[model samples]
Target: MNVILPTVITAGLFDSLNPCAISVALLFIALLFTLKKDRPFILKIGFFYIISVYLIYYLIGLGLLKAFSLFGATHFITKIAAIVTIIFGLLNIKEYYFPHAPIKLRMTHDARFKISEWAYKASIPATVVMGILVGIFEFPCSGSVYFAIVSLLASKVTYLTGALYLLLYNIMFVLPLVLIFVFATNRVVTEKMINWQERQGRKMHLILAGLMISLGTIMLLLYF
Candidate 1:
């Protein structure tokens, strides 16, 4: 999990370049404003929100790592996972360009509130839970990358190394968002970028979604 964290973070940052990540972040800010009009705390709240979202995403990745491991590299399950992943990837591509056929992501909160409160100081459990949530966000993209990375590392790397990879992957995926947050913190430019993202947002989503499905299909085919 330790090493996989980095991989997942970097991968996540890569995926973040996709328009979907931008849209999600934008939507979150919009929602925040709707709830509390122009509150000064928004930027900070949004910052934590990004952290929380990424944390959740990273954690979800761990489960994926385990599932792929159980299937291994040379088994029926691996073949099937590969097939399904490829299919999902292709489907994502189709969904990307078609405005009418958007990919539907089902998100679940598996974090335990009580335990999180108890573990708040060091935030060990909280961080793990956050990563789990982030990983589940994987439905729309990275099927190709996911398959390839997992398959390649599953048999060879130690669990900690894998975790590092995951952490890095997610960090990269969210790097843009991190940057956006930084830019937004600026009083003058914040509104402009947000407005730009809001207006031309769909392009990002479509493109990123396309990348995920296309690459996922490739990885699936190669592995199979």
Candidate 2:
């Protein structure tokens, strides 16, 4: 239990630093600013969007957990997840070094376009839909930590307990978005954040690469 708690928290925090989700979130903030939406309106839209992300991600976690339990192959799946996480880490490292590589872990062009289209609307419902899109599309780039954490939970805990940990993990996952939304209410702050993210984007991938590789190695050693 002690090990699980720290693992979940660390994974969630690291995953929250994902460039895919952060870039989209910054874009959403920038769009709302461009539309001349007031702070309250922006906050309202951001609130719903963040909620949509949280709900979608939590539900997805639930589904994964249930699937693992149903299959009664938690050990097998955990081993596979560990290996996949290592592969994902290597891919992230590749992204940092060779961003233009033919294979990339990122949202597709079409997904980005769709998200942008909806984000331009700047309506509460539209933002919610866009959030859902972000949640779904950002998975390929940002889901490795989540997949590993979920697999660990399946192997180590019961369904109900794992569900509670999922709640904690996801709350941690969205904490940065919440902070970003709140601070980005200021245009200058928003611009600076955007700049910061651009500068540190590749570094974020590198960090994730290291963390994922370490976690995967640890999981393999301890469980497999």
Candidate 3:
């Protein structure tokens, strides 16, 4: 079977742009600076957080793919997923226009509060726990894209291939965080990074919407 690396890469890129994760990471970076100018501590906190998020996503993807493949191929369900994806895309696009729209892809207030509390502690274990919790919190917002990717994987490849794709997807998902942390700690474009996010946050939503719409349309066409 042909490996759908492109799909995995694109999905990972889109999923990684989720505001919840990025916002929290940015806050953590800021907290790190406020707490101390300890570069090593910053690196350790960021590393653990990123790795924990990747591991949680990998486990979820692996288990879900295995469970999904057990049912064998389900073209009908895939078609439904495509439709749902398109709806999610539209909702995302709507959010660009109505930023306060009832439909938003974001973490719950409780989750946000918990993360903030954990981030302030600036401990490796706490950061790791925060990462795991954040991953779970953000899943509802970003899971559709991952689900779509996994559905495609289950339909087109074997379980092992699906697992490999999940691994690749998660690595790419955390790449931006890794880069952002490195830059912030090095004092390279730290302020610029935050500013850019402020300016491009809405635009990111549009881009994700377009990506989902395109991917869903193609899936619909392919499956039908």
lDDT of 3 by residue, 1-224 (tens): 54489878988998899777787788789778888758888888889999999999898898878877887655766777788888888888887898897767778888899888988888888998999998888887667788888888888888998899899999999998998888888554666777778888787778878888888899999987
What is residue 222's positional error in candidate 2, in angstroms? 1.3
Better of 1 and 2 by lDDT: 2
Tens digits of per-residue lDDT, candidate 1, 1-224, equal 34444444454555676544555455444544454535455556555656765776666666667766775553444445456655654554564456466354322233233323332322334434433444345444444455545554565576677677777776776677777655665444556777787677555555555555544555456556
lDDT by residue (tens digit), candidate 2, 51-149: 999999999999999999998989989989999999999999999999999989999999999999999888888888998989999999969889989
* Model 3 regions more than 4 Å off: 1-3, 186-188
Model 3, residue 85: C-alpha shift (Å): 1.2
lDDT value, candidate 2, whole model:
0.92
TM-score of each: 0.63, 0.98, 0.94
TM-score of 2: 0.98
As a TM-score, model 1 comes out at: 0.63
Q: To one decimal, what is the Cα RMSD in angstroms of model 1 from the true structure?
A: 7.0
lDDT value, candidate 3, whole model: 0.83
Model 3: ten consecutive residues of lowest lDDT:
186-195
Query: On lDDT, who's better, 1 or 3?
Result: 3
Positional deviation of 13 in candidate 2, in angstroms?
0.3
Poorest 10 consecutive residues by lDDT, candidate 1: 106-115
- Specify the poorest-scoring 10-residue window by lDDT in model 2: 1-10
